[model samples]
Target: MQIALTGKLAKAMGVELEPVNDEQNPLFTWTANWTTVWDNRRAEDLLVLVNHATRFTVAVYQVKRKDLKGMPEMIKQAIANTLLYMNINPEIVEEYMSLCGDVTFTRNSNRKAAAWVTRAGLDTSVYIGHEYNGIAKMFRDTVGASINYGLVNYSGKFDDGFMPYEKMVTALTELTGKQAYKYRAFELMVTLDLDVYQAERRIIVPAGLEFTRLHEVLQSVFGWRNYHLYDFTFFDEKSERTTVLTEPLDEYWPGDEEIVLIEGRVLADFMPEHGTMVYTYDLGDNWEHEIELLRVIENYDQESPYLLEASGQTPPEDVGGVGGFVEFREIMLNPDHPDYETMKEWARFWSPELQDWEMRPRAIRV
Candidate 1:
């Protein structure tokens, strides 16, 4: 692996730069921005590393001027953290480095690191003064946001709409025969726990998705407006209890049980074992969904999760739970009934797709 460092970092490290051939080996470049803080008592530097092939900001680190001496170990740890953030096994760090070749120090020739580091610095500037989340979390969030927005959303800067994340994953999969951390795709069966209606949605999502993004995928596939609170309950086999993950809110929970925040938690962390997890939405309406992981799809090509199949129309929001849904369905079945037109109009208000009075479910990508 070739790691190119800026002249300042090279000078700080007391390393002599040697000219090398531009081979096909994987290359990464490092750049930094220094700033003084706390009344100029200490100097802070933002170290940014960019993958030359993918042009992805692979790792980011914040450190003091004195800590630069241990940059060799810091770079390794940062790469491991970035790989973990991408849902890739960090254990392959050494193997990946070996596959790329020996570590060679060189001065950047293409001048690509400056642009990438500048973009990273601008994208992460808002988190510089954040009270709770430090630079590590900020880097994780930046990486996730970039992947979701650029790769999954197909909004990359390339003219041909190339995705850097996909390219990197494909390269790694080819290099390593075992797909240990290629982001396994899980096929999930989500069924609405209703006594009458048979609403079920089959979805395929990458295991690396965060709970918050998974919530959005559910909302899109089920045609929900995402207007209410929701929580995911997963059974912990070891603890013999259920754990709840939800968005942090200023409300009181009944027990002292630790509630996990869904902000930075990925689905792989609390994957439900052969059993089912409950996704409860809208505390008032109490729409409980039974989510089951059916199987893992091998070699899934999609960047984002989608609805593989759907059946039965979902109930409208604020329909007063299952009883109200039953009553509404009964009225909708009988046009001669007095409240038929009223209920139909109200249902149409919630879902404009009910124009033909028929529920049509189809496959869709979220």
Candidate 2:
């Protein structure tokens, strides 16, 4: 990337000039500090010119004090010059300005702008700090442009400046929000306590995900075949309240004062940060799982539940809970016992590799 100064504005700002190519350098990253090349020049204010190398596009950013104070005429002139330079239709811009009308720009506002620009079939997106959110919003709300935050990353905080370019690019590539865009996502740590079996699984899912969907995700994570009923009971330590959100069963009901249907409720509604929840599956076998909300991540973009980490092998379903599973495992390990061959055969039939029972933390995506 190279920085170059151009035009009369550059000379006025005491910016050092760089050689200009016949055609703009195809892969040169340059910053041109030409303060308000448009009519309203302020000695105190700063302007920047950014040229995107690969995209071969140029954009101007005007940075000024939060409050313009008494620069209405300057602002009007800058707006006119920008409109002319960008070659955007005046009628469309007018409609957008009228619709947004003095909106503040935030980090999300930048994201929305990026989304909009992407949708508009434009290859580039720009960031202008001087109250440009209104214009960005106009592009967003009107044309449904997908703002590309990748172009320029601003922290939107008064203290923190723009995020480092590398970090910004990394953030843009990763899953940073819920798939639905309406609900905030959460990173939960669900662990199954097999008691004497000493087996557990660490799983994560979105907060807005239904408990029923979570049930299926857990089934996959633990290698369960989904052959039993499950229920989730959330406990808030601070408030000392228990909320039972579970599937409705015809055969039995716990008769609790507040038994909510799990089908409708989301995890975020009841699961407090660092709070605990008990998830019991298969009433007959009583496979219990302990769930804790580790953290709530706003604007996370993980669409499906996935296994983050795991330890030990999951007990086979219909193994008569923890005690039965422990006993079965012991029997299979004892080769000298009379029933060892029979139990081994059964275990091997289900698991295949019975000898490789090492409890090590393994990371899995699904």
Candidate 3:
């Protein structure tokens, strides 16, 4: 990897340069806007992103760390590789690359443009949770779409029939609302068995508040004095016993027992963006005992003690209870925000990992 700029335009702006080359990016540098280059990466040749921005690295190819002798070419290589990774036609990528070397251009915009940073939510900060949800909810209820707020560099709001960003503020103004974000305890889901049994129950509680007010809430919800000992059953759609509510693993069966798997719906109140599910299983004998257990499981979301360990890991279908692994594999769109194409590239890199690692959604007192 190397960099070699034929003109003095990039240097005059104190713009740092680098040569990138690797399997994904077979070029020297990535084609991006100037602001994007500055915001997403360090100005140094071996530019790297820190914090949440690092999640966006997935969009780039591995570039060989080298010198600036062929910096432009290397940057071009990285840009080309990035285009290819993005599934753009080679001809289209080439066209964009050619623009970078246009000798006729002399203006700052053309020279300064490094990569795209979205200005769509410029003045708005999109809150994905309930922290700023009051405005969003008002906007959604009034306009029937998600509204944005507190954008760092935006003033104009967008409006679409379905979640248009522009008109959200107007709608919010009409509704009279204000919103803020407050961090609470992280809920943990300690799932031990598939929610297929009658008495089969899944408990959700906060990570650390297991013995506080939340503990009492859990006790009251299921009407149980204690849930230390109970029996439950797991059943399939046909109402047949697939697995007993004994343990996460099938200890009674031989090596090749198949679990009767079941599907459940997940629901969240204000923070619907958080993952959730409602599973129904057979109560069996513990059905009476588990009523209280269910209360604790449902109430102590912030104090629950469950963490998703190995996703995409499932036991063979022939292995009874071990086969109830549910992998919610949905491909979410990773689109760029207006001109902030830099964030788009970053999202493509981080989305997959974030989707893979998730705790159960928080349970509100809806």
Which candidate has the top score in TM-score?
Answer: 1
Per-model root-mean-square deviation over C-alphas: 7.5, 18.8, 22.3
TM-score to true structure, per model = 0.58, 0.46, 0.23
Off by over 4 Å in 1: 5-47, 59-70, 84-94, 100-109, 120-145, 148-159, 174-186, 193-199, 204-229, 234-242, 246-274, 282-287, 295-307, 310-366
Location of the lowest summed lDDT over 10 successive residues in candidate 2: 137-146
lDDT of 1 by residue, 250-304 (tens): 7847453857777778767766443568888998999998999988766555444
lDDT of 3 at 351: 36
**TM-score, cand. 2 vs. native:** 0.46
Top-down TM-score ranking: 1, 2, 3
Candidate 1 residue 278 C-alpha distance from true site, Å: 1.2
Location of the lowest summed lDDT over 10 successive residues in candidate 1: 139-148
Best by lDDT: 1
Return model 1's CA RMSD, one decimal.
7.5
Count backbone overlaps in model 3.
89
Rank all candidate structures by their lDDT, best first, as comma-separated numbers.
1, 2, 3
